[model samples]
Target: MNHSPDTGTFQVIHAYTRAEAIGDGVLVDVTDTAREAGYLLPVAMTSAAWAEAVAWDETNRALQDEAGRLWDVLWMARPAAARTGFGQTRIAFDVLRVPNHPAATEPHRVTLHVHIGPGDDGHAVLTVLLAHED
Candidate 1:
């Protein structure tokens, strides 16, 4: 429940929190590894983003690993975040990802969008999702 000056007090019917999302696997927590990449704030990736951009398997294992792919995503995000206005709420970045598709022969570029918004407790959190996701 919350109060507002313009509107009367109202109760939140329901809410889905960042923690819940992570627990449910809708979001994948990458805060620890993100810290290794220099991110100080909480970081998560949408499940779709994970499946499409970061998930790696034995099909591509001979050439890559999950850690390396995750690192690449963060490494690319850094400069995109830096070049954007500090006050901006959303940042867009691209990564040249090697397809996990067994028959693919080259890396393909994909755009990932980073959204900075209030989490369940109101602390700002970052979410990396596909460009088409919210």
Candidate 2:
């Protein structure tokens, strides 16, 4: 796993893999202006074969795998802020905390949005967005 900041949002780039039949993953420790908002280990992968193993309910395992992974993002994300479209899906998770900074007036609410889609070669593409609510 490798990550960089995209604008104000923290972005993570990952390649999915299986070791001994278990999925490899990441744990993100997000922070607000005041303090830590806790952590999330988002599940992701690149191949349809891996998706098939994880998406047990899909008959069309390839397509189902994409949706299933998107669902995983949705599980941790805020429902009112989520969006799904042609070839792509986006979801946000809110981190809760009260800001104690001297210059701060509002509680810091960190929102994490996960964007997912299919690459040109049909592999999965995932992008993560982290932002604070003013």
Candidate 3:
């Protein structure tokens, strides 16, 4: 994805109540509109910050992806009770830091930490952090 340049310094911001999912079996209903909010960060940062942000994003993606896979496995293991009715789930993410750069004078990289869990209302919630580094 590409980011526009900005003059402000970038910082990690929390993306509360981002993605969502519901349903059972292999046919899970998922939505990722929350991911779009992450791009709102600044667009330039220091080299160190940029590297850190990139690392954070990489780690975050891996963790979230793995969690999703695990969820799939769990769903498949269930017989019927867990498959019928509505199964609640959630995912959360946290942004680490923002990078700085002289060329852009803002942070362009964004890092996110994601978590998935079951919601109280028989639904799934996804938590995610959106950070931008320059």
Candidate 4:
């Protein structure tokens, strides 16, 4: 993605990479003007912090990609409900092996929440809450 050299804060993530990471099922406009696909990290996140978040033992890009694939499966399974109103679902990911932290030895549970609702136009909006566990 060619992140900015400054690894302190405000690392510039290419919009295309983010979009590809999310998947090709939906189109996201990431331009400054559109801002439809804005990347909103937790308020306290600096570039270094973001790096740590991605490099964490339990949760990382691979897990996120798995969750996205799972979401596609979930969407296909709810075709009947999707015809009328909103359909929401969630799945838990048991952080495998390697424990959750550098010291801890037990696995932790991370949940991915999916919200499928009607979009502004004729399309649909698929919102995935990547960090919601409960």
Candidate 5:
């Protein structure tokens, strides 16, 4: 079926929200940490980004910490967010991340995309997702 964009007519179906994603582990809310890092808006990371950049276990404790890793991700995002646009909706950024792979010996470049959009309640929010993710 073809739907017109101008027509304010649409059927309510399955609506997955940011809150629900965080609650369901699909998205990890990092707004607190972001604020600590000097961010003014709410921020979140996709499950994939969390797994690759934020997840830390005792196995990797000797080499890295979750806080440091998370900080690195946010640190890189800072300049990228600013360099691209002042108030753009979408921005693509890259960060060097030490993957959670046991075989990984060095940091690899990972592309992360940031989308600034309306929150569940109409507030501005940011969602960081893997390059291939929506």
Candidate 6:
């Protein structure tokens, strides 16, 4: 089956993280922030085959594979504040997928934007953007 690039769409799954206050009582310790962040963000891909897989709840498998391969690159690319928890941290993101004339090998691209500090409830908010390419 042939899928049109313009038919693709992006979706945001959820946002989550594991964080602990630092010893200095000034920051928090977030281990494996990238992995955690990745999990929080939804998966995106440009493949009719992959999209079909996702419809059947098989997207996790694809995400696992991609994450395994790109974890290092994504993790290292994370912002400094995200690496070291200072105050309450929040990563807010919006996932978008747009069809192109010819789909690229990596159809899905995750654009992540983070926010640090406590919310009104005095809790950390991690914002994530999940985009899937059609």
TM-score of each: 0.87, 0.27, 0.21, 0.27, 0.84, 0.27
lDDT of candidate 3 over 40-116, digit per residue (tens): 21111222322333323333323423234323322322322122234432122323233323333233323332323
RMSD each, Å: 2.8, 17.6, 18.5, 14.8, 2.9, 17.1
Tens digits of lDDT, candidate 6, 1-134:
34456867545464332222224322232335444755333222223312321122223322334333334323533553355365534343333322222332234544443444443355544322223310
Name the candidate that leads on TM-score.
Answer: 1
Candidate 5 minimal-lDDT segment of 10 residues:
79-88
Better of 1 and 3 by TM-score: 1
lDDT of 2 by residue, 1-134 (tens): 34445555555575553232133233221212102212222233223322222223334322334344334434454342335455447655654323322343343454555555554346543444443210
Candidate 4 residue 49 C-alpha distance from true site, Å: 15
lDDT of 4 at 43: 11
Give residue 67's lDDT in candidate 1 (0 to 100): 92
Instruction: Name model 2 segments beyond 4 Å from true.
Output: 1-75, 78-82, 86-88, 97-107, 119-121, 132-134
Compared with the true structure, model 5 gives a TM-score of 0.84
Which residue pairs of candidate 5 clash?
none
lDDT of 4 by residue, 1-134 (tens): 45555674465464443245335523322222212223221111112212222224444323443233333323332342234343333322222322224565443443333344433443444433344322
What is candidate 5's lDDT per residue for 2-116, written digit by digit as tens?
4558996776667899999999999999999999999888999999988877787757524887888889889888766565446567787887877776666588888888788
> What global local distance difference test value does model 6 have?
0.35
lDDT top scorer: 1
Output the lDDT of residue 102, model 1.
76
Candidate scoring better on TM-score of 1 and 5: 1
Task: Report the CA-based lDDT of candidate 1 relative to the real structure.
Answer: 0.85
What candidate 3 gets wrong by more than 4 Å, as runs, is 1-104, 108-110, 130-134
Clashing pairs in 1: none
Worst 10 residues of 2 by lDDT: 28-37
